[model samples]
Target: MDRFDQLRILTAIVEGGSLSEAARKLNITPSAVSKQLSQLEDRLGVRLFNRTTRKLSLTDEGGVFYERARAILADLAEAEESLASQSGQPRGRLVVDAPVAFGRYCVAPVLGEFLRANPEVHLDLRLNDRLIDPIEEGVDLVIRIGQMKDSALIGRRLSKSRRLVVASPDYLKKKGRPKTPEDLKAHACLLHSLRRPQSEWQFMKEGGGVESLSLAGAFESVDIEVIRVLAIDGLGLAQLPVWLVARDLESGALEEVLSGHLSPDPDIFTLYPSARHLSPKVRSFVDFLVERFGGERAWWATKL
Candidate 1:
């Protein structure tokens, strides 16, 4: 394999934390990845990694080599990006990630327009609710909701959304609508399993303080969509994002309650690695998304 190719493989192996994961990320067979790594180490005449049956750790030499290799790769990427900018077109693979529900309902619907506009750019979109490190995963951009905690990533605010307490018309008819946050305790409140075992729901008070409720229910799910579906089926009350249940609320399938006691609003953001010269692919996509859904332009937010 070429030296640059070997560098990429080594970087992927270190970042992915395993040969198999690196192979998956590179879209190559694990055996080939192992073979290439072995050849690269043999040619260098030094052990680069300490390997066990289940773990791989870099040796001192490997660490130094990896750092230098990463710098070279970054320089190469910057050069390409500079050239692409001069060409005034984005032409490369763009990897993006977003939360499952938001990706499905909000982001995925708008992807066709982006691809049609930039025919030379290949898009790879991955959807999951789990928080992932975009730098480690080699993702070009990530759409995230809620508070962003990583100062290393450069984030641009796209829009804002809040969790709304809602229930199906039939559910409210049967259980009576909650007059306040305190009334939520007497009803079946769908809880997220991923939250603390004693799930707490906080709401804004009438006078500008916060009221927190410890809630339990017969049903709990890790998936927000599942909870939304249950709430739509008249099963229980659910606290869901405005973007997720806007249509249900409009169609009279779900009704919002305790509007005065809504939860804190969380902003949507697009995050990427801080770079000196941003690639056209990343910049174009971020701008496209902002134009389409940023600020007051979000369809779900507008429905309210």
Candidate 2:
């Protein structure tokens, strides 16, 4: 096997966590993926991974190999870029990942403009809320809404978002609007148990002190859209991301409450593998996003 191909195969296996997934990514059969890996290990004189029926785990040597392989690949890319600096246009596949609702409602419009502007660039946009490893998945950029937990990658802040406590006029009329954090518990909350329903709901007061509260509801959903529709139909209250409910708040379909005890601030960011010798495609995409979505577009701030 070619040395670089061997490294790439290993990277894919590590990222995909399944032989089938890696094989599909490489555009080959599972048998081919296995054979190539075995041959690669024999040539390297070390076992790279611990394989079982369920999943694959990298050995200590394999971890070291991953770091070296990435360095080598990055160097090769830089060398090629240096050589082709003047000759090549930004012509290649640019893969981006984003949350489903935000990607459709917000990112799609901006990216549509980008595709129109760059005729040579091909686009692949994947929308899912689950965090996927960009390097492992071969994604160039990930437009994520929260802060980075794994500080290994690079992050560019694109926008700030907030969680708002909102309910329909009918619901508030019947259940009564909450004036403080403690009051939320008395009302039925249409919760999203997907992210943080069982735990983690805090409010930041105007002077910066924080108060926490938890509410159980009759309706709980993993789907943001479901929660939105439910809340609009007056199914209790919902602590929703402002981006998801901006227009509703603007049109007064939903009314905001507890302004003094606002939820913790959330920001949107674009994450990539590394800044050093970053691909021109990655740089261009991040710049484009910041130009479009970057700035203080807090969806919670009602229009005057």
List TM-scores for all candidates, in order: 0.73, 0.69
Lowest-lDDT window of 10 residues in candidate 2?
295-304
- The alpha-carbon lDDT assigned to residue 12 of candidate 1 equals 100
Task: State the displacement of the C-alpha of residue 130, model 1, in Å, after optimal TM-score superposition.
Answer: 1.7
lDDT tens readout by residue for model 2, 30-139: 99889989999999999999887876899999999988987897678667655544554554667899998888867775676888777767789999989898888878
Q: In candidate 1, what are the lDDT values of residues 19-134, reduced to their tens digit?
A: 99999999999999999999999999999999999899999999999999999997886677678889879977789999888899888887898999999898999998787878
RMSD, candidate 1, Å: 5.1
Which stretches in model 1 have alpha-carbon errors above 4 Å? 1-79, 195-198, 301-304
Predicted model with the maximum TM-score: 1
Model 2 earns a TM-score of: 0.69
